[model samples]
Target: MSRLDITHERASYQAVFALDVITAAGALIFLGLASKPTFQRIKQRRFTAPNSKNNSARDGPLKTTLGTYLFLWPALLCLFIAYVCRLVSDLLKTAGTINYDDDLGWNGRRAYSTADSGYASNISALTFTTALATIFFTVLLNGGVWIHSSHVQENGTGISTPRTKSRIWNSAIMLAMLGTGLAAWGLGIHARDVSTGSSGPHALLSWSTVLQHHRATRIMYIVHEAIVVAASLSVSIEVLREYATTNRNARDSPERKDLLRFAFAVVPLIWLRDIFILYDVVLLYVDTAGWSATAVDATTLLLVVCRQLANLAILGMVLWGAWRMSRSVALFGRSYYA
Candidate 1:
């Protein structure tokens, strides 16, 4: 390739690496959650639920609205379908066909070549669009949950106001997640594009569009990071504040303790994910020659693996919850409580 002719492989966030594996696993977990009747069955299984007293999960009536289900499941399905296309596109490509093969920055480490990489590029605009769609659906799914997370207390029980303070903030975290998703999508798209002159002078892509994508990625990166840090602090404070009351009578409840352990462990992983991602983002800006670029790649690989592990733990709980929840659904998908 010419000196100025730069080509890219798959985008980091959407690539079927350690991170997307984690995300794909979570898709089924989310699909189950979107099924209101099934989810309610899981969370409301008081018959077997231990020490129902003072449990935040046990208080509120289940959210079984059809509108919520509609918003969630379709978006979730889109996410899975998007990943499938991405993975298939990856599968079709040769291992490492970098446009700048001589450069150490993208030499042996990259996945596949861009559509503009050569005459036989594996990834097309279709894969690019699907990559974008996956993030969009992810944000949609989270937003649906954000709106509903506020129902911590039953309306008429009158013990305390719904933990609206924390719930609202949790929703805000979901909003941050949306921002991060969009940012990643933008970067991935721009990175996948064929260089302006590499394909043809006109080259289906415009400089302005690419620049816009880069700009969005930059702006959203900051927003996503800032909001994630804020949410972590907010969530930590909320959990600690309520720890005394939330777990006051919980010594007898092994189930509650297990759930808490899982949650506490997952928090650090989430932070780790953000840290590695921030490192990658920095590389995007000031990343330089030689071992530094390789180090950025290495650290990023570590980050994706760590994040996926966290997701596996968390989504395992969701799937487990779904399995348990399914038990509460009687014959014909009806709630056992009904």
Candidate 2:
């Protein structure tokens, strides 16, 4: 069969394309709104004296600033690019010109795969970079949440504690950096393999199959998710602490409320995505004993749609929280809220 003699699930791709449009639009709007505050924070940091009291890092603690927490700008931008790429890739797939794999493609579609198709290799490269972008976004945001909570706790207390550095927190950050690097390395290997036609029988969109077959990528994915879950859990604890300490009637209550929203609403969704990932792995690789073929297909479709929807929801919540925090900064110039 010719490479172009491929069939695709038109309705499935159409649904995904629609989702991509909505997510891309939301990400664009977020970027536009975030640019001002993000830049203003940068400008403020440049002009302000390093020794100034406003410099939270001057004494001993990590510097907490709007820029530090507003990683949502780049995060959203990454997702936007990823979504747009997906849209384009879907279009290509519909035209039966992009590479596909019989073993990995949806519904056993026969087509050229990553091992043969240039377009497929390039798409794999894009997927690697975008996945790294997402990992960075989550890790950075989680760290920011923790550090911001620490700042809140320190400043909220009128008493001056010792100016000693937090060796423990510093060590944790370093370890997380190490893990992120390892994850990147693993993902890079996977991408390189795909591009060089070494990753056998891989399809452009066969993420679950890739994980199941590629040991390095699979291990690193688990590591990456573990790091995310750990960081998110820390943030959850810190947010709870903020809620316990913060006075509802206080001036900085809005900041507390925003954190609450992040913890209660956004964090849970992140956990949910991770759960879906774990379940996807289980259904795809682990628990396939007596499942009917129809049941397996249904589960696959359900996981694909639900996982993407979960991701979209997480992106929306994080963007909304960041926007709320940015607005708080606009109203009260570099206060703890920002």
Superposition error at 338 for model 1 (Å): 17
* Model 1 lDDT tens row, 52-169: 3333344434322332334455666676666566455444343334342222211112322333333233345545566466455645544433222212212112234235675575
Please provide TM-scores, in order, for all candidate models, with all chains considered together.
Answer: 0.59, 0.67
Runs in model 1 lying further than 4 Å from the true structure: 1-79, 100-127, 130-134, 137-162, 176-198, 201-213, 236-244, 249-255, 292-297, 322-338
C-alpha lDDT of candidate 1 relative to the true structure: 0.44
Candidate 2 regions with alpha-carbon error over 4 angstroms: 1-8, 46-65, 68-70, 97-118, 147-209, 247-252, 287-338
- Model-by-model lDDT, in order? 0.44, 0.51
Per-residue accuracy of model 2 over 1-338 as CA lDDT, tens digit each: 12432245445445545666776777677667567767777766631123234322124433334533455556666667766765555444343333333232221212233333435545555545555555665555554455444444443332221124443654475367557646655665555544322334444433433554566776666666666666565556656655565544233545456556756776666667666656644443343535565555555556655555565666566555544533335523443432
Candidate 2: residue 279 Cα off by (Å): 2.3
Q: Quick one: best TM-score, which candidate?
A: 2
